[model samples]
Target: MELGLAGRRALVTGAGKGIGRSTVQALCAAGVRVVAVSRTQADLDSLVSECSGVEPVCVDLADWEATERALSSVGPVDLLVNNAGVALLQPFLEVTKEAYDMSFDVNLRAVIQVSQIVAKSMIARGVPGAIVNVSSQASQRALANHGVYCSTKGALDMLTKVMALELGPHKIRVNAVNPTVVMTLMGKANWSDPQKAKVLLDRIPLGKFAEVENVVDAILFLLSDRSGMTTGSALPVEGGFLAT
Candidate 1:
């Protein structure tokens, strides 16, 4: 239960709100010092105010150079949570190059870049750290209009395995948490609309979407020493959606 997380330094992207915000709070509660990154200064400030052990860093993960520079300033991260992502829903024919590029940039490429930067620091310091990528049920199950988002997350799931193999030599573990629809602001704004919410919830065996806490708890488990043997695995917190 201790999680043995005291004094550990964590970096969580997309920490401004929703699941990222909850993750920052959860890590802080476990006595970990968190460097929270997001594009919004105000939201980051608010998160810092609400969470005692969090240090807010406002850097857009989509901006590769800026993210690397900002991360360089905060060296030696023990845990890296690649939680920042974006989803744009559209028919395959309607999906433009810009949308596809944005999805890849934020959801897939950003994870790869940030993990490389943070993992290097961990390896250089000879620290056995953990990296948890926030994947989705979409990574495994395809939805009608989720082509672009699903593809990016599917790629991320694969990246998790490859990173685990590459980083294991340095004692850095890489894993992923694939959750079904979580009741975050993004979920509310997009899927929680009256008709859409009903349709979405129907697919879940639990007959409800996941709470932010559910995803946060899974992430913390992967980050902790309790899951020391866990690497290159996609742990599903899917409310049994995958089972059904």
Candidate 2:
């Protein structure tokens, strides 16, 4: 599974932990230089200690000015992963403006902001690249108390399609990996309860949730030449949850 991605430079958002962290390690192992972006300095510091060739960038993706200033000078990136997101869960009736804005800010708006910066660099340099938007199964399926989160992800899916249509001509592939409740820090905090976990697990044909590595594997494939022909795809890493 050598994706022929060695020596490439990649920028990964939300690299503090979970799937983003794992993806950084995987890319580094494959010989790619990585710029790890996270809001937390401690997470970025810890990541650099474990992975070589990592350039850590700490910026809150939700901050328009800070995000632009930090990533606008990122130079040329052959690959980009828009994995940073926030899940402000609230029942549909209970959803507040604050939750709506925060979810949209980190989940969708920051994606557009970061991708525009990276994609523009790629276009200017005439470099063929890949962009992976870390969407969610909630994008296509309804989940209680996830009104705002689901809306952002659904918009992200459409955004991926539009990016492929527009950026494809420039040879920049854009796609999304829609994963079911991955056992990330957020996932464990929400689903560690047996009663809650079983409610969703039973719907999945595989009767389980995904692990960080499971989603990271999909991200790497989409970023690599292995998926050269793949663009505008919403690859599901949900272990049959959406199927059932």
The number of the candidate with the highest lDDT is: 2
lDDT of each: 0.90, 0.94
Q: Which residue runs does candidate 1 get wrong by more than 4 Å?
A: none
Tell me how far the alpha carbon of residue 145 in candidate 2 is from the true structure, in angstroms, after superposition. Answer: 0.5
lDDT by residue for model 1 (109-164), tens? 99989988898888778889999999999999988888999999999999999999
Candidate 2 lDDT over 42-64, as tens digits, reads 99999999997799999998899
- Residue 25 shift from truth in candidate 2, angstroms: 0.7
Candidate 2 residue spans exceeding 4 A from truth: none
Q: Give TM per candidate.
A: 0.96, 0.98
